[model samples]
Target: MFRTVVMIFFACVAGVATAEDTRLKRLDTGDDSRGWEAVGRLDIGGKGFCTGALIAPDLVLTAAHCLYDSLSGAQINHEEIEFLAGWRNGRASAYRWVRRAVVHPEYVYNGKVSADRVRNDVALLELHHPIRNTTVVPFATDQRPKKGDRIGVVSYARERSEAPSMQEACRVMARQSGMLIMSCEADFGSSGAPVFSFQDGVPRIVSVVSAKAEVAGHKVSLGTQLEGPLAVLKAALAQGQGAFSAAPAPRENRITVGTRNSSSGAKFIKN
Candidate 1:
């Protein structure tokens, strides 16, 4: 069953690390996952992987694009997706298959970068079972951070796909047209990584990595603000519009990747 409440609370209290002096630390060892057990790698049918965060024991937050096949552009089956919590050094605290997934109602998999697309590139994955381990705690979702606010990201990217990396020094460079331009470094396979804002000395997810772009000669990561689109996605899931059930779903019209090319303010590099 779907979890009614999506928010989560951790047991212990740790002061939020400031982004001023923090640098990206690769979690190649078990000790590196002490405070980031909830962040995981979402493997899409062994084709590709994206970063995801646990908002509820059964719910994973990631980019909507991660649910689609990169070559066929069709929505992948939930059974093909798996979430590996606290993945580091070739191990994980927990591994579970996805039962269902719901994308933002307004999101269109058009293979293009636009304000509207970036604004709604969020998705929620329902896990087959909840990860209730003592260490693998889910994170809480919060409102979008204001412009220039210090934010952090834990992600698995192209070169660093084996282990996740924590970048606590990233900042929200700008918020325009409902999208967040962040200084956080993102690359291929980093799509759907959570953008966290520290609240009450805890990490709360505010946005999700969608793409990496160059803005005004400055390379920045693009993210979808979670305030509005997340609600719509939850509603869709409540209505059973975009979720998998016991029976298999009919195949959707396949859309190929990188079909639409838009040369605008941000150069859309799929991450």
Candidate 2:
């Protein structure tokens, strides 16, 4: 299938991450209007890459594969890894770093038993100190949006196709797939960008950027499917963040983690 599976979420399937596409609409990246913050500035062999986010003062989330590299079919060294927070405008707030990172043990990047086959492209990062100004983690339940819901994307992407830049808002064309409808595009540096949906005057992060764009290139945006797989993720995420503190989704809301209704006009993508 030519899919690049990441080992954080799915078990094992070869070639399951990318499709054959690329031409996606770009969102405006003028000034990170949505206040998208980059997770870290990596010096990977003198080259930089993107990483997780501090949705709360102490809880950080990102694609598990980024830290471990379970998809390139390559071996990675873990001891020399580092994480930085509040990375923006070429100057990090000067006070952000990760004390510990726990990659999902079952994570797979490429062709191992723990292959990056499913693109289980998400993870939780715990910080040494809680971010001062950061409040509650702004994470929404892991679920795909309805076919035509309005959504937002915030990520630390490489600008000019070659530098780390953050994207604030981009209309998610389809609720679950297809292409994004903005210029604030993403790149290798923009994995794990939180995708939020606007509802009841609040923007809730319903998904995270998952796989690489399909070959058609419209920029396929895969939101997290919270209904079934989050049990493992929740437990994995709670190892240090205490508990997932998301408010119980409104009863009228049917897209919650464990529910059996879709009358609210909100539906969940199957896991």
Candidate 3:
């Protein structure tokens, strides 16, 4: 039973690829980033980047693993973080520093990869200022996606860091133990990428990419089920736990969480 369970759970890094493209299309132009302005790059202390989405004018949601160091297991200072909305070719619709960040308490940084870990691999970031640009409107989030539900993803990954990409036809393969197995291709730096369901004809975040894995030779993506973990993180932020309030620790050059090794040769920081 344990072997079977493990087999069912250990899938791999999948990127956001559409049926039409079979690979992610870079949103390198204003036209490409049109409705995806809110999906931006979370530049972490100039060390690495992760994909994040603005859920509110001041709140960015991403994978919890983006908050820690993969080598030292230390929490990355929120002050060193910046959000570049609609980042494209050295430009952005808006830029803001992070004021506070809260990871799910249950999320163990640098912990072993597993379904339980993936389920809790979510975080919320509060920006120092709210982005009020008309073009960078925040996105709405909804309930988790069901099995086989068609979904979409927007993210930034290695070699594609200058801009984001959109994969409009990924599918949810299964849901088990609070983790989502998706057909979407998630590469390194894709951690915290939002999984959207277009059930209502409008995009709504349904999950946050946690890791990528492979099962039975089929590549797949892993993500955290959002609603519950998001709520917990919100409450934690309200209580001022883990918020960036003091001077950050001395900086050390190391691989950022979620960018180490995966199908795309990218790290999976959400673990």
- Among these predictions, the greatest TM-score belongs to 3
Please, what is the TM-score per model?
0.81, 0.57, 0.83
Deviating ranges (above 4 Å) for candidate 1: 1-23, 244-271
Clash count for each candidate, listed in order shown: 1, 35, 21
Off by more than 4 A, model 3: 1-21, 245-271
lDDT of each: 0.75, 0.43, 0.77
| Pairs in clash, predicted candidate 1 | 191-271
Candidate 2 residue-wise lDDT at 246: 23
Question: How far is each candidate from the true structure, as Cα RMSD in Å?
Answer: 9.4, 11.2, 7.9
What is the C-alpha lDDT profile of model 1 across 1-271, one tens digit per residue? 0001111111111122223755678987767778798999998887889899999898899998887765555778878989999888788899999887888766766565566677788999888899999999999899999877889999998788778999987887767668887778777888999999986789999999987765444445778979788888777767766555443222324323234532223333343
Q: Which lDDT tens digits does candidate 3 get at residues 1-271?
A: 0001122323332333434444678887778789999999999998788999999999999988887766666788889999998899999889999998887767765445655467888999999999999888899999998887888899998888888988887788777768888888777788889899997699999999887766444566788989988889888878887666443323323333344322222223222
Best-performing candidate as measured by lDDT: 3
